[model samples]
Target: MPRYDFRCRECGSTFEVSRTMNAASDPARCPDGHDDTVKLLSTVAVGGRGAAPASGGGCCGGGCCGG
Candidate 1:
């Protein structure tokens, strides 16, 4: 079972859950017994587009090969 992140809307508590993919369709309530928990997206998504270069400066000592 893969783990997914969830956040409790009532208390703003983040948690991890392990269950089958189908379980994500109807998630369980928070341990506090409130049905205000919502699944959070992957960290990669929060970082936004990631196709950018690794470094702003060239890697080959500015030799123009990478500069």
Candidate 2:
């Protein structure tokens, strides 16, 4: 299950719901029993190891130089 963030316009409260991707667009009710809600754009965080930093600085500290 994926968590989705929603904001209730009636009470101006934010809440989260866990549901399947198929039902991601479904309307969510707030904890205060408010039916008027809108899904909020969520940010995805990626974890795990990425490319190691360049050893020596060449251009832009070798970070963007792909050294």
Candidate 3:
């Protein structure tokens, strides 16, 4: 399951929900029991919290200099 942020335009409230990827884009009902909710664009951090920073150097990380 993945967490998704939703905003209810009907009530002007925001909420989060954890659902299967299959239903990630499904319409959401606000806590106030309102519809017209929309999914928010989220900033996803790969590797979870406190994960190690990616190693390697070079602009492209391939060390080929992109040439």
* Every model: Cα RMSD to truth: 7.0, 4.5, 5.1
lDDT of 2 by residue, 1-67 (tens): 8999999999999999999999999999999998999999988776557856457767766667772
* Best candidate (score: lDDT): 2
TM-score of each predicted structure versus truth: 0.56, 0.70, 0.64
Evaluated against the true structure, the overall lDDT of model 1 is 0.76
Lowest-sum lDDT 10-residue window in model 2: 45-54
lDDT of 3 by residue, 1-67 (tens): 7999999998788999999999998998999999889999998667877798786887766677865
Best by TM-score: 2
Ranking by lDDT: 2, 3, 1
Q: Which pairs of residues collide in model 2?
A: none
Q: Say which prediction, candidate 2 or candidate 3, comes out ahead on TM-score.
A: 2
Clashes of each: 0, 0, 0
Over 4 Å off, model 1: 44-67
lDDT of 1 by residue, 4-66 (tens): 888899988888888888887567578777788899888654444766555556655456764
**Candidate 3 least-lDDT 10 residues:** 58-67
